[model samples]
Target: MRILFGLAVLCAVVVTGISYFVLYRYVSDVPENKICGNIYIGNVNVSGRTKKEAKKLMEQHLKEDAALEITMKVGDKSAGATLEELGLAYKDIGKVVDKAVEYGKKGRLFTRYRQIKGLEKEKLVLNEGFVLDAEKTKAVIEERVEVLAEHAKDAGITKSADGFDITKEKKGETVDEKASAEMIRKYLNSGWDHKGFKVKMAVKTEEPSVKASDLESIKDELGSFSTDAGGGERWKNLKAGVDRINGSILMPGEELSVHDTTAPYDAEHGYVEAGSYENGQVVDSYGGGICQVSTTLYNAVLYAELEVLERYPHSMLVAYVDPSRDAAIAGDYLDLRFKNSYDTPIFIAAEIDSANQMRFTIYGKDTRADGRTVEYESETLTTEDYGVTYKENKEAELGSMQYAGSPHTGKTARLWKVVYENGAEVSRDVINNSTYEKSDQIVEVGTMSDNAEAAELVRKAIASQDKAAIEAAVAQAKGMSAAGSDNAGEEN
Candidate 1:
């Protein structure tokens, strides 16, 4: 019995040793540069393959995977491009391939033998070859999806013979860039089957501020005013300024600045040298006649019953509008700013008609009571007569005189806005109080150096502070100088 038990134990031990030697030899038989049997690198079976051969196979798989189409859908609009077109390429796979090759070849002979044997029951699969640049991926996504983007359009108004034409507003659509890029990344890292992909792109909706319905009620002509659009370069400036301001829609509580809308008054912006008021004189400046446009718009706004937030009078009175009614826009300090205080939006229509008149017509919903009328009255509180001013001119012939500028009368005035209901007076409100500086009639008197007599006579005439006396003295001195020139010519 003892001898039979010993024989059974020896047979079992011998069988186990033979199996261990077989597994160890199998694991060791794999080429030094070859991956062990039953190992995969990212779904590409590299079992029993050299490192170079495994890399070649993985490169082929990467090419196919890169060629796979990635589709992004924004609503029903879809954009698609292959991963290669989107600048995606797998990171270096040499290390991962080496890792796979080293598997079942590490540790003691028994451990390696057991690993090689375990491959038959549970195959080794490695997650590799999907890393991509984040910025590059996002850039491609944005470029491809740009065509799917739509910008929101606000409702617009156009003038018509009947009333106004309201254009319909449109909603916008844009892609969610971050989420789209992340979706692709997450799928490639975990669930990618080396095939084409379809992603429902995250899209955002944009709303319009003034919907078509909101402009439906803005059809009435609230107020309209027409001023003389002056001629020449000033006229062209007026046209340019008016063109910028035309078709402007001012919503409720929104203010409009004449300077802001038509600024940077340079030749590039279509403005040329034209006459404008500076230092109590009319001088040539860029966008010179811009104030007339603002004044016209100011009157229209006043008649429309809009709120005037800022207004400034010209240095002197303008011939186009009343003293207190004119609105001047200079640099940034002076601007004709007004707000749409009505419950609805307002539209400004400006043009220089064939009659050489610049007109600004305000159109909006008229909520004023029926039979109610509005009018503005200008009252002169005080007035001062301008005097004659004489300045000496050395180059002119003796006693010759020239007018430098026209005289301006000084006045303190106030404007009143009166509301009448059913042809009966109801309320009167003071709009503004303005003061205009008086300018003297500037006359340049000649002071010829050779003629002391003529110079003294001109000086006495200027001191008299009389226009007629100064003119007579200038004429006499000019005649004496002419007579002396004629006598000298005859003697020669």
Candidate 2:
């Protein structure tokens, strides 16, 4: 019994010594010489180790698990606590350091867990701002440049004697290159992406040959004129008049006026006779037959369907052209002008024939409305009559203004409306109120008692186109009548 008890005691003492040694070694191995808080292997601090030892140990542990958890403190939280409860992780300190060293060589690198989180936020913000997709914006700016170039080309800058032309140079005083460049730059910097943007452009320019051809046609039409047909100087005078209208160019969208082109009436230009129009009781100086040219161009403009900016009609009946259809120009007071509103270029060709007839033709691309047709209708709206004015009978007495003579009646002024249509009634407009002047009546007073009877016999003779009849009428009337007399005596 004694021997067994001694053996048991010895065994117990040995076991106790072994336990103490093991505890001492474990406590010593954990560094106590450095600053201490908690033991951190990978930012994860566990109690019983110094901060330096934990950091060193963490670097060693990262070799095995590069993605180790990191430990963060919560309010009043204890060290070595569960990271899950604090919504944090203990990241591998050594791995982070290694990664930072690698990426830092290229650019910025995260230092701590907080820094990594901050970097993620910054990346998101940058993505929301300026994008790197320059293809779309670049294309949009390129397209704008092309369109601006085309517009510049169409605004033709021609060299002419009228002035120093500066339109053709790509960069010069007249070129709008700066404006175009700025427009394009502004468009690109407007923060738009043109990933799926589309553009449709139409470019137009006037051909040089077309412009030359138009001028040639005008010259040909005006050049064909002859003067020596009639014995009178009227034909010669008319030829000189037609020569004035030459070498004028009408640009697109420009208006050409008749009064603007006609030369001033002067003896130097061979205008011998002045034109006159009756106003009230007296005749007034006015441009005479210029209305013929104006009216002809007006008809041509109508046929071309150009935009009529302004137009006026003659005050008195004109025998050269239809009364209501005539267009009259009296300097700035009245004008026959039209604007070339078509997209293509247009030229006006005017010709005056030897017969004192004028014609105007417009040349341009055919712009006829394929599916449309126009119709015109005329309607009389109103009429008015002015009292007749009489001329003194050369054969009558001084107080005689009327006698047995052919009575001339005044004409009724009629207002007319012209309607224009295209598939439907486009517009209905009133043209003008046309007035006609009346012819006067006169009676011849003769020395014979049968003066009235003799005057009637003379009237029958005057009615004939025979030259002898006109002479006989004149002789009988003169021999029997006094100035301003109503009759030599009551007419037959």
Candidate 3:
């Protein structure tokens, strides 16, 4: 039994040795620069081919990919990107090709036998012919997607010579970056079979918040106000008030308060003492000129046909606007308020010009028919002489006295808004019924010596109503009299 086993082992060894020799010779028989049988560089058969011949064969297939262009589409919109741009490219296959050519040849007899046998059953596949550069892919994908992206546009309003017009809203669309790249990847993995392809793109939609039709009716200047602007803390206060109200916007039925527009009424908020109504007297206080801004805006709101929500008439008549038309605001206690009743959004534009004029313009849709206009007028309902209050002094010219500025008359006034439809007064509506208390006519009486002669000269001059005679008497009185002096020019 041992001898039979030995003979069988020897027969097997000799047969195996012959097989190894045959495999080795087969491997060596391949041309120096040619690949072994059944070798593939990404489906491009290179077996039994020289290095130059294999590269040429591969180049023909690679040329197809080099010129490859893929269009990414979202709905009907499409944009194209190149394979080279997406970093899906093939290059430097010489080393891999050379390795495949020397596969079974560069090994021991047993190894060579196994390699040749294995190759006979399955072909050698090399993925080195294709490489992916991630950065390049990202850039290419974004560029292509951007070409198909549409940005949404918001609604807008424009003013022209004729009137105001609105711009309609526009929708936007875009592609999904990740999904677009994935689609390209699947196509690339197909051995770049199709030179050019169109991929189904993922799309998104964008909407606008404001619409043009929402502003279609805002076409008129409702109400407006203007006042004198002068340089000082008072002027600064008025300008600061205007700055606060500048570019203010309001929706339909919304109200704007004077106090809310001008807050923190102090030097810290840019206010300076100017003339203002306080306790029935014109006094200097912080935020003094700020009321003029409110007054101007109030008038603009009225002309624009907006509703007057809350307003207060000045205790003393304001000189900037017509009497009874002035809007007075005192801190938080008193405010000038108005509502945007035009059924659309309104804008406030306030400005203090170089010509000492502060103007407030109200812009909104004008629903007034053609050839229509509005006007506000102040009518003096009743008038009465201001009372006189004499203050005694110790001067010798007892009767001689001077009052500060001019005496203001006390009166009750009514404000009326007259609407005209096509050059005719259609109707008149009362806006304000204001009453003002008379400011006392102050007289400084000289009490130093009670000079009867100077008093007689003054009375004679007043009787004549002659300017030269009164001036001559006053010059003689100042030169001769002694007690109290009249300082008329020293008053504000």
**lDDT to native, each model:** 0.85, 0.43, 0.74
Candidate 2: regions farther than 4 A off: 1-242, 274-276, 280-287, 354-357, 371-378, 383-387, 391-492
RMSD of 3: 21.8
Q: Model 3: per-residue lDDT, tens digit, 17-69?
A: 98777876876665666688898887677888887887788778776676677
Model 3 stretches with alpha carbons more than 4 Å out: 1-219, 392-406, 444-492
Candidate order by TM-score, highest to lowest?
1, 3, 2
Please give the clash total of every predicted structure, in order. Answer: 0, 26, 24
Worst 10 residues of 2 by lDDT: 124-133
> CA shift at 488, candidate 2, in angstroms?
20
Of the candidates numbered 1 and 3, which has the greater TM-score value? 1
- CA lDDT for candidate 3: 0.74
User: Candidate 1, 315: how far from true, in Å?
Assistant: 1.2
TM-score of 2: 0.37
Task: Look at candidate 1 and tell me the lDDT of residue 309.
Answer: 93
